[model samples]
Target chain A: AQSVTQPDIHITVSEGASLELRCNYSYGATPYLFWYVQSPGQGLQLLLKYFSGDTLVQGIKGFEAEFKRSQSSFNLRKPSVHWSDAAEYFCAVGGGGFGNEKLTFGTGTRLTIIP
Target chain B: EAGVAQSPRYKIIEKRQSVAFWCNPISGHATLYWYQQILGQGPKLLIQFQNNGVVDDSQLPKDRFSAERLKGVDSTLKIQPAKLEDSAVYLCASSRAGGQADTQYFGPGTRLTVL
Candidate 1:
């Protein structure tokens, strides 16, 4: 089965500082990767997705992620984070087959933006 | 466009009680999904439907959980004789189609607390 791993359970970053969240996946084939963010008491919002084409993908809210096939990683990055960026982030992997294309997500990383 | 809609922003129930959640997907979406998110973990898909038909329910706890999308536009998820471990956030999502690359848009989840 395809699985995602996010090593960091919690990450604290100062406002205006750069941010990076690590994500790794285990899949036999080329996997479709996604990053999602969830504020407290809210449902998830897609940050970005990588299916094919360039390894780097830009998403809404000034976020980006790079899919590194050799490392089995799809890490999310932000050049500068704002206080509003504090949220729980999830990494997910998909692309198995037609009916089996549901996503498998990592545990997630809770981001805390310090002033 | 308007995002997915889920009802009963929060629900509290005791063990062995029954509870249900309602979801209305974005207009024109053909795929609906139900996910359960335990505290500190990412959302895990429980069931998926495509145009009023079940596409996947392999991860759903069929013994106690049931879900349906009758008209292919709205969906309902029910838990009978809920257990303590059932305390989690139930999220509903929809996509244009049940394909490998389709992006699923989420709704504000229904938080369930099983006492």
Candidate 2:
């Protein structure tokens, strides 16, 4: 079974500061990873996804994540944090088979931007 | 393209009551999914439909939860005799197909509060 782990429950970063959200996954084979953002009272929105391509994948809102096989991590990073970036982020793992495209997500990390 | 759509943005019901959520996927989408997201936790897949057929529903509690996608475009998830623990956000997502690389688009989700 594939599982994702997000260590940080909540994080606060000053506006214009760099931010990184840690994500770890446990999967037997090459896993398809994804980053999703959810605002309060809103559904999730895809940030980016990693299949079998470049290690670094760029997403919307100037977010990027690097897939590190050695560490089994796909951490989300943003150079400059904006007040609008404050939201809950989730890490998910997929790709078990054809009928197993469903994703297993981590608990999520709530980000707060302080001006 | 328009994103997935879910009805009843918020619902409050007493314990043991019945509730249903409706979802309309993006046009031409062949895959639809229902997920349960508890507060402070990641979303968990409850059921998945591939063209009006069940592809995955192992996690759904059949005794209380049931879902169906008719005509392969719209879906509904119903919970009978809901429990207090069942109070969570029910999210509906849709994808182009059942491919591992297909990105899923989510709806605004229906927040369920069982009193």
Candidate 3:
């Protein structure tokens, strides 16, 4: 089974400060990792994805993530966060499981940005 | 391209009442998924369909929940005798189902409040 764990339930960061959200996954084989953001009353939007080649992947909204196989982590990072960046972020792992397109998601981390 | 679409963005129903939610995937998307997201939790897969065929439905509660994608384009999820625990956001997502890392686009989600 593929599962994701997000240790931080809530995080508060000041505007213009750097941010990092931790994510850990358990899967038997190589896993497909994804970062998604959800604002109030909106659906989730894909920020980035990591499949095979690169350990570091860039995503929309000036965000980036690095896949560390040794640690079984794919952490999302941003050089600076804006007030509008306040939202819930989720990490998901898919593939290499019972079903082809099934995804296992983490509990999510709610981000709060203050000026 | 337009993103996934869902109907009845908000619903308030009493316990033991029935409610249904609808979803329409992107034009060419072959895979559709229904997920239940409880407050402060991540979205959990309830069911999945691939071109009108069931791909995975391991987590769906068969006793109270039922879903169908009759023509493989539009889908519906229904809950009979709703419970207080059923109050959550029902998210619908779709993917092209092309490869290992296919990204799933999400709808705005229908927030159900069980009174």
State interface RMSD in Å for all models.
Answer: 1.0, 0.8, 2.2
Ranking by TM-score: 2, 1, 3
The sequence of per-residue lDDT tens digits that candidate 1 reaches over residues A1-115 is 8999999999999999999999999999999999999998888999999999999999999999999999999999999999999999999999768866789999999999999
State the local distance difference test value for candidate 3. Answer: 0.94
Give the number of the best model, judged by DockQ.
2
Q: What's the CA error at residue A3 for candidate 3, in Å?
A: 1.5
* Runs in model 1 lying further than 4 Å from the true structure: none
Q: Return the lDDT, model 2, position A94.
A: 97
Task: Please give, for residues B1-115, the per-residue lDDT of candidate 1 as tens digits.
Answer: 9999999999999999999999999999999999999998889999999989998899999999999998788999999989999999999999998788889999999999999
Error of 2 at B102 (Å): 0.4
Best by lDDT: 2
Task: Residues B1-115, candidate 2: write the lDDT tens digits.
Answer: 8888999999999999999999999999999999999998999999999999999999999999999998899999999999999999999999998799899999999999999
Which window of ten consecutive residues has the lowest lDDT sum in model 3 chain B?
B95-104
Structure candidate 1, residue pairs in collision: none
User: Model 3 shows how many backbone clashes?
Assistant: 0
Q: What is the iRMSD of the candidate numbered 3? A: 2.2
Lowest lDDT 10-mer window, candidate 2 chain A? Answer: A93-102
Q: Which 10-residue span in candidate 1 chain B carries the lowest summed lDDT?
A: B95-104
Per-model DockQ:
0.84, 0.87, 0.67
lDDT of 3 by residue, A26-87 (tens): 99999999999999999999999998898999999999999999999999999999999999
**What C-alpha lDDT do the candidate models reach, one value each?**
0.95, 0.96, 0.94
> What is the TM-score (0 to 1) of candidate 3?
0.97
